[model samples]
Target: MRMRHVWMTAGTLFAGLGGHLQASDWNMPVGVTDVSREVYSLHMTIFWICVIIGVVVFGAMFYSLFRYRHSQGAKAAKFHEHTTVEVIWTALPLLILVGMAVPATATLKKMYDASDADLDVMVTGQQWRWHYSYLGEDVDFTSNLATPREQISGESEKGENYLLEVDEPLVLPVGKKVRLLLTADDVIHSWWVPELAVKQDAVPGFVNENWVRINEPGIYRGQCAELCGKDHGFMPVVVEAVEQEQFDTWLAERKAAAAQEAQGVDREWTMDELMERGEQVYGSICASCHQADGSGLPPAFPALAGNQALLDEPERHLDTVVNGVSGTAMPAFRTTLNPVEIAAVITYERNAWGNETGEVTQPADIADMLSE
Candidate 1:
């Protein structure tokens, strides 16, 4: 009995972790899209079907138990087989399943039809962050957790959206069909937004497509549905839908900024600039594993504060960053990061967290190496 109780407790905790339920929130969200509504409709339909089945089956079962109780001197009516009863039960269930499958299949077909989209965006999942790149628009940026370390560590009060907040929210135009191409770098990740009814796996080397057409313009939050790594719970997805004009304006600004950053590749960067840029990059891209202070969660993620191998072998460090070590957690950043960001982060790592090597790897040098 004690062991059974322990198993039940464990099962409940695991179910909660799987995002199936909370004390207050048990039902699936009725999202802000047409397909979302269809999904909700289907969910409720199946749910009520199950409920009715349980009621009828249990009602008959308890009725039999009470009505034909041996304690009440009720004799067992021995019956071999009833073809009519068997046929009715089987036919009813088959009909119910066919009824359920029709709507589910229709919803799935609609969800998969990501054709003739107004915009196309590539969503790449990194260790614990999301990178959004607009196809042909030349607008892309990494979105990281915006919650402060103090809040995570219990040093300060947690905000309302603590883990749900991100440094950048994916902006889409309301009433416009935005097609999302999902893929991951290291492991399998699921891009899930409850309100949008978008939960798709980002399998490495495989691009899974899904689309969303938001009926309302508002902010929607979600998290990595897959258990990618240790910081899986911290990976939040925030999408902000706005007017078409507003999205266009945002895209223009992003494109202009991209152009300016692209031009920075030829210029010589000072230590201050590199360090500043590197800190931000590291905090978003590398800090999840290496930590905020360079003191990594070792064995899996070694400490970089005074690592002799990294300090002594600059060429090896650059190679390791650009071309990741095979059969390890490190991913090649050649495609993930641009030349400028690569140089800035490398230079910053050499100098930050009491590991003052005074090494300044310029953007030009990094670009040249990348070309080679």
Candidate 2:
């Protein structure tokens, strides 16, 4: 009984370790994988089978080697061929292979069935962020790492989420099939979430699709599975899977916000109001690479104070913010930010600092441009 308990303990430890032993670092996740668990079971099955075979084969070979040694005065047999032994060895391997292949083929079939999804979301990988668009809905947003640079640099206490937090989490209704369309803007990236059993490449100028149907409603987190750029590790993917009713409520709220934005454009606001609202929006959206004080990280993120691109030419400023300067790190804010937001940000930049143009751009102007 004591020996049996010891074996049980050992077996439990081995099973627990098996889950995380492969990539036992923060590099690759280990909680659960779509095909990995199946693969692991297949591995263990084949491994034990091999162990049994190895023991039998080696036991016979060693027994013959020791018992038939010439030093023991054993007579050498004249017969050179053993058809029975050769046939047994060949047939045994073939049977073992067939056994392994059966389960493997089943798992492969399940992994490849990426159709008939209930929900479809397009996941576009940018240089240092992820943009998600809910198909058949006007809900779309970019998710960025919310972790501060100070914490990342070890200058402060890292939050609970740390490098795994995002400003916006991809929301989904639980127990529903979700199809993800993956692609990249500049380079190759990979979208991976272990719990949901998703990992697909975000290739540039190309689209790949993967599907998942989460069993539970919870927050699932993952990082950029592929190396994107300088801030590759900073790009994290967070998913909030909520109940159907809760998801509907969230969707309704988003639509209301969109409607509010449409009404806000035509209505005029005081400079004080725009500045106040713009400050918050800019801090959340633009303060990562660009410093909070309008003094951006030099060389890479140029300061907006004396920027010719933003100050000298208003057309350039509007164009760059809306359409984005292609082939660069500056992603277009048109889709991410509403007209009122865009106008407020543009106004804040123009009027702020000594570059005082005293020009106020109403949201209506931005809306008109977007229409064009």
Error of 1 at 290 (Å): 1.1
Per-prediction TM-score? 0.91, 0.77
lDDT of each: 0.91, 0.81
Model 1: residue 99 alpha-carbon error in angstroms: 1.1
lDDT (10s digit) by residue, model 1, range 1-372 = 998998799778755654553223677888999999999888877886896799689989998999989999999879999999999999999999999999999999999999999899999998888989999987888888999889999999999999999999999999999999999989999999999999999999999999999999999999999999898998899999999999989989989988998899999899999999999889888888889899998898888899999999999999999999888788898987888999999998999988889999999999899888
Residue 209 Cα positional deviation in candidate 1, in Å, after optimal superposition:
1.2
- For lDDT, the strongest prediction is 1
lDDT of 2: 0.81
Q: Could you tell me the lDDT of residue 226 within candidate 1?
A: 98
Residue 279 accuracy (lDDT) in model 1: 92
State the lDDT at 216 in candidate 1: 98
